[model samples]
Target: MTQPDRDPGLQPERTRLAWRRTTLSATVAAILAAKTALHGGASAAGLVACAACCVLWLGFLLVAHRRIRDLAVPGRPTALAPRWATGAVLCTVAIALCAAALVV
Candidate 1:
């Protein structure tokens, strides 16, 4: 038995674009977090939160970049692994929390 040809259509392209948009959003969030942290007198806690935000942003970027690269491959891309998905979600949530902390 043989598998039938699958029409990839624009799905891969769309997914890749979505990831790019997400990366851009994350970048903006990180910048805002830093700005908020600095707008107030740079307290030790604020600086620490800012640093955490940057680290989380980097983590997300790594995950998004890998997924985008995988989508660009010629053949059918593999499904996202559970571990990577979890990591991405955790990073996103952590970034949001850090940003909120900086604002508050």
Candidate 2:
């Protein structure tokens, strides 16, 4: 089979997949953090941290959406998204801390 010529343009599917992965990570992190904070012997300080993480998680999604939209226009130049996967990562860290503070 002959291969088709590929443009250097951004792959839309790749962008969608990246977004899906980010969203899923955020959701999983949120669920885990909330659960651990609520049931895993979370301290007042730990709970506050978890809440902050949840906020970060939401922020990540918003940033990701904005980035995707910006990248959608082929000829439009835009600033790159921040390197930090803030929300999902923050949530994960918060859950880990909560689990440690409470369970471990």
Candidate 3:
């Protein structure tokens, strides 16, 4: 027997779940950054920047999750997370710099 056509809504649901997973990973990364700064004897400037990046990254995650939930509803168009991606890139850079500070 032939399978029935899949609903378009499934696309958004899958995308939403992917976003949630990404956000969760980001939160964990932020935590790791903080721990590295605290225990690695990172320089003051580096530690501060890493900590700030963690806070900002969390904010991005929160906003992305909220937007995904809102988009899951039938009436709303999907909201793309441009800001979150940008924040993630910046946070990665900050974390890298902090790690470097620990070694050098």
Candidate 4:
């Protein structure tokens, strides 16, 4: 059996997978950090941090899905650059949560 010719232009699929993996890792990190902070006696702060992290993760998930869909279909009239703001937000939240966890 002969394999079909792979379209090299669809290379964004690799990036899509990477985005998914990052989202998953961030989620796990958030859960662990929130749990630790709560256990360390920063109940209120920890809960808030956890909620914020959850929201951020959801945002990332939605963006990742949209990006993957966009990548799947090429040649659209308007080309959009990936939103770096989302990534910056994720990093900021993660850092804040980590600090909150440590202080707790």
Candidate 1 off by > 4 Å: 1-8
- Per-residue CA lDDT of model 2 for 27-100, tens digit only, reads 78767767766775777876886786577667767767776776666554455644545554564575566557
Give me the runs in candidate 4 sitting further than 4 Å from their true place. 1-6, 40-42, 74-104
* Candidate 3's TM-score: 0.61
Displacement of the residue 85 alpha carbon in candidate 1, Å: 1.5
Order of models, best TM-score first: 1, 4, 3, 2
CA displacement after TM-score superposition, residue 85 of candidate 2 (Å): 6.5
- Residue-level lDDT of model 3, residues 17-81, one tens digit each, is 88788778777866776776677577787578676766767666666767687757764455566
Pick the winner on lDDT between candidates 2 and 4.
2
lDDT of 1 by residue, 3-102 (tens): 3444447688888899999999999988988888878599899889889988999999999999999988866888989998898899989988887676
Cand. 2 Cα-lDDT: 0.65
Which candidate has the highest lDDT of all? Answer: 1
By summed lDDT, which 10 consecutive residues of candidate 3 come out lowest? 1-10
Candidate order (lDDT): 1, 3, 2, 4
Superposed by TM-score, candidate 4 places the C-alpha of residue 22 at a distance from the truth, in angstroms, of 1.5
| TM-score, every prediction | 0.85, 0.58, 0.61, 0.63
Colliding residue pairs in candidate 4:
none
